[model samples]
Target: MITTLRFTMLFAAALCAAGCGSDDEPAGSGTPGTGATTSSQASSGTGSGSSSGSGGSGSGGTGTGGDVTTTVVVNEISAKGSDWIELGNPGSAAADLGGFGLCDSDATGLCNTGDALRFPEGTELGPGEYLLVLGDQAVEVGPGPHTTCLAEGPSSCFYATWKVSASRGETVFLISPNDHVLNQLEYPMEAAADGQTWGRLPDLTGQGGVTAPTPGAANAAP
Candidate 1:
């Protein structure tokens, strides 16, 4: 991910598989379709509700800082069906995701800094690859990325201090190595609570909106 932005709101009510994401321990045993919910609409550009432009893969994030160029972008946010954060690499080359960090604001307000999650060293995401981080603080981190649940079937999630709200709304921030905001999402509760998920089809640089949950894969409609 890259760039700095004032605001980018993605509806939390977007995509998610029949099993949004695995909330249970391993993979198949976990039950999905019952995580955080989402809202509606994804706005790009300057303001909060503007509806135009794809703005590249690295357009939205938190705070202001130096500019960095990385292909990994926050591709999908599944509030409904299940709760998980999906990141993707759109460039042709693999991205060295080491040291990247992200955080979520209180379901009611801005980020609490202390809840930030820093990627482990040597973390990586191949070109066009998708990584899913389930939203559940109960699971323990294992060998995968920086910190995440054990190498489960496919989706090995990392935990966070906060959970995206389907009723009140939530803001998730992606930070670059330099601590600059790589991409930020602040979707409303209406969007988070309605749609199955809010995601970008065609992968990274597409428009974000309500769609089916295709975690660890490309975004698509049901």
Candidate 2:
């Protein structure tokens, strides 16, 4: 009986050791398999970041638009009896002449003067339309299909306070609202005859020549 009891106790001790060893396992022996999944997840995160960066770069390439430029021209000038300057808009769109300036100078290029005559607010020149700016002593030279005027008071005539010399050649400048010179022309003293006017031959885009005084109408043949 004593031998059998000792054998049973030895068997029970061996079973308990086997069960405890299997339950404990090695601390991190199974972690290597899980590490592969973590690495795959890290790779996925990196790809996501790269895609986000690409989208950000695409959003930064949309700031290269075009700029607006003026197309109006100084079509005609008269330094005679009724000192007037004619501005024509041959473009397709109307031009807002408000805040635009006009100055008489002897400079061959752009004229910069502090006493420029600025167009009144709400002044506009429609497409293919002509605007006549008259001087204080200017009067309608002839009669035609031209009767629109922009004046401060209740008058049907638009008059300018500035005057151009009839004997001396001078440069006339058309300035934009931002103080940029739009167009300029230097008239000769010979072209400033009492009853004549210097204008673009074909209206807006032609060579300058002296013609009959057409205050608000198309230039006539010399």
Model 2, stretches more than 4 Å misplaced? 1-68, 106-112, 136-157
TM-score of 1: 0.62
**Model 1 misplacement above 4 A:** 1-65, 106-110, 139-155, 192-195
Residue-wise C-alpha lDDT for candidate 2, range 40-65, written one tens digit per residue = 00111211112111111111112222
Which structure among the candidates has the greatest TM-score?
1
Q: Show the lowest summed lDDT stretch of 10 residues, model 2.
A: 38-47
Q: After superposition, how far is residue 145 of candidate 2 from its true place, in Å?
A: 18
Candidate 2 TM-score over all chains jointly: 0.57
Every model's TM-score: 0.62, 0.57
Error of 1 at 206 (Å): 1.9
| Candidate 1 residue-wise lDDT, 1-222, digit = tens | 223222222222234323365566575655777676432112223323323222234422222345454667777777765677778777777776666676666434444455667777767788878777766454355323434433431535565545677676666666665555555555556564444777765567665666676777787764
Q: lDDT value for candidate 1?
A: 0.58
Instruction: Give the Å shift of residue 194 in candidate 1.
Output: 6.6
